[model samples]
Target: MNSVLINGITMTYDDTGGGSDSAGSVLLLVHGHPFDRTMWRPQQGAAPGHRVVTPDLRGYGGTQVVPGLTPLSTFAADLAGLLDHLGVRRAVLCGLSMGGQIVLEFHRLFPDRVAGLVLADTFAQGETEQGRKERNDRADRLLRDGMSGYAHEVLDSMVSPATVADRPEVAAHVLGMMLAAPPEGAAAALRGRAERPDYTATLPTVAVPTLVVVGSDDVFTPVADAVFLHDRIPGSRLAVIEGAGHLPNLERPAAFNDALAGLLATVRESARDGADMTES
Candidate 1:
């Protein structure tokens, strides 16, 4: 894990040193609402040779929050700044839920900087203005009420029943992470979600290699949402992680990692073929 300043926000991040073939491109993992970069650790550990960059996101983890800045578009700009700071020319993006929204927004802002995309448990369009406000209101309430008060209720929606019963530690770890979030962090994430752009219109515009993955039992972002993204994003592939829920990376780490590795392979192969075509 490391730190860098982007858009005046001190962003905290971790990079998995890529394997032999990971040099030319990087994998940037964006976490969901209320979750820090640690959410991607299980998947990062499983995928070797891929330079994985996990940012705690503004207002999450150790990231220094920028005051007076609001709106979700700034978050996308923040990502572009991070890539510039790291000297990443172009990279593959793997983001979950809120993280997925970040990628979509970034693509709109910095399309040329992205090599490919992997959207997991995410959506392009959701939340009416009222829905957004209600969610934000609840998050504020939880932050004030102590995360533990809501953590138990959230677990059922986060992980599959099997994981909760079979992998209690997994649930506990996720719960702990949620509980540790500061009130400001939680509020900032809620605000970001509220201001997220409707990316459904941009789906067909994404021309890079792509993958849309989700757990079969993801209640927050259902399977239908993944299917919608797959059908809309030109040339993108879709994978349904079985026996998993919202947090598949934690609940089914192996499968999540494998899906990521596969997305990388597709991107690499595409790049290689494009080079050959240019040479010819």
Candidate 2:
């Protein structure tokens, strides 16, 4: 992993070496909450010929943890800074769960920087008052009891009973990520996320090719949410990985990678067509 100073924090990231003019487009993977960039290990080789860069958010993984409210906007800004540092003018942004929301926020703030979007297991609506309270309450509990109990409690729902029973290693990796997350970082993210804006309006405005993916058995943000995104984002594709839960990329890496590959092909083709027109 490489390190760079972004927004007063030493942000850490892994960049699979590739040139700017490479045939593959730059793919940026943003991790979900209570998880780090390592969650993307399965996808490191998925985008063949592309530069896949995975970064730990400000507080998670090896990145510097600032124990305070870190809004999705802040996370988005950190990404923009990282891209600028890497000399990347634009990228195909792929994110899951909370990471998905961060990608949307990044598009909202820096639309020109996004070449395409891959939103997985995430929603666009704002939190209800009750939901906000629950998130803050959960943050408090995490601060009090730490992440072990919380991670254990939600393990099944995060993945699925089938995954836990069948794919023990995948289950272990998910649990390990949750348990290893810095409680302060996770809590602060929760607090800030509770105040997140409604991105429902943002969906129809998406100009680039987009893909909305969800686990068939996801409880947090189910197939319905993915459909809503796909329906609204003009021409966006939707894929539901069967027998998987919230973290489909981990539970069904092959299927998840297939969906990403399809989207990447679309992006690459579009880029080539645009370049041809410009040259003509």
Candidate 3:
């Protein structure tokens, strides 16, 4: 429920302490549509030795939508600015869906400030034609039929049928989160995704360590997409969690935690090496 003034909007974010990290780095988690930053709680608890900051993002939760900004990259810039405000020069950025897009854009905008990146159930680049049209259509549908009508369609894509059947409340909460998003905000957010560039071509050049994680059943952004990204991103790891769909971090928390722990260990060790090289 805490707020950070970024680009004139009071963006909401929560910074929860997670164990200790003498390395002086923070882990920033960005949530996808319909949900605020709280979607990342499971991963935050799993990944210790770093401060975890989950932001509600602009137009979500208590954050306001600002006028004049492009809405999408404006989000990236806002995130970077928030880091600056927090006196964090570099940190790992973990994003899901829209959050992944934000992470991509933020890296594009502020490369130096990013220590690493985690793109979960997100495309390497930008949106495809069908995807763009579908999101736009959903936006229009939400506006026309209202949140209640569009909630299930928007929320159900994240989890598999087995999950919905076993944990009905999980599905319900996710759907509720989608239903609760401000219409104008959701519309604008969709527009931002539509206009983003594909980052696939730029993956190899990414300076920071990257992790592309997906669920075995993520039809939204399949395992193939993660593999493609992994192949292109030099050393970036590709992790797939079973028994989940798009939201692996939420659906299969333990597996997500294990994958995350592996990545963090690798990154921290590499960072130590770089630190040593600098010291010498």
Candidate 4:
């Protein structure tokens, strides 16, 4: 566990020291909304040959939450600052759900710093008017009733029925993460998320290699969303983890890690090819 001051907020992150003997090839893992860096524990030590970093986004985990709506751009900038502070010039950015939107914003703002992208269980569309209203309503409810009730309410939707019945431990873990989240921070994020721009126009412009992953049973962001991304992002690969839900990385770590490992290999190969072209 490490902390850095980014944009005047203390951001908490974990870095598994440069996992490879190579250079400028870190894997930055960004967690989803209402969840902290702990969600990435299943992936820790999984990327043996590449440095893997998991950071708690502002207002989650040990990080300090800023008052008011913190836009996705702010989250992107904070990540850029964290990379700068770590002396990393470029990295493969992997994000899930809201984290995926933040990655898109990061690519929009600092494309040069991104080597590749892994978007899991997330979509490129912004919230519709009804979606915005629903999020606001949920935010208000969270502020009023608190995390305990809200966590339980969303658990079924977040994970599959199989997970809830067969994997009680995983369900408990997810609930715990949600319950521990700061209500104000969650509310602020919901509001900020409601305003996120649609990435439909931006996806076609993504020049880097991308991997679109989804759980077969993901109710929030279904496999259809993954297909949408795979079709839009040039040369992107799509991997669907069967019998899993939104948080496939946690529910089925082995399958998710395998997909990630494949993406990392593609990224490395692409980098090598570019370097060869440069020398030629």
Put down candidate 4 lDDT per residue, 158-204, tens digits, no spaces.
88898889899999999999999998888888989989998899899
Q: What tens-digit string does per-residue lDDT give for candidate 1 at 111-181?
A: 88888998999999956989788867876776578567777788789889989999999888888778777
The candidate that achieves the highest TM-score relative to the unseen native structure = 2
Poorly placed runs, candidate 4 (over 4 Å): 20-24
Clashes of 1: 2
Q: State the weakest 10-residue window (summed lDDT) of model 1.
A: 16-25
Q: Which candidate's lDDT is highest?
A: 2
Q: Considering TM-score, which of the candidate structures 1 and 3 is the better prediction for this target?
A: 1
lDDT of each: 0.82, 0.92, 0.79, 0.90
Question: In candidate 3, which residue ranges exceed 4 Å CA deviation?
Answer: 18-24, 67-71
Clashing pairs in 1: 18-49, 19-49
Off by over 4 Å in 2: 17-24
Q: Tell me each candidate's TM-score.
A: 0.94, 0.98, 0.93, 0.97
- How well does candidate 3 score on lDDT at residue 274? 91
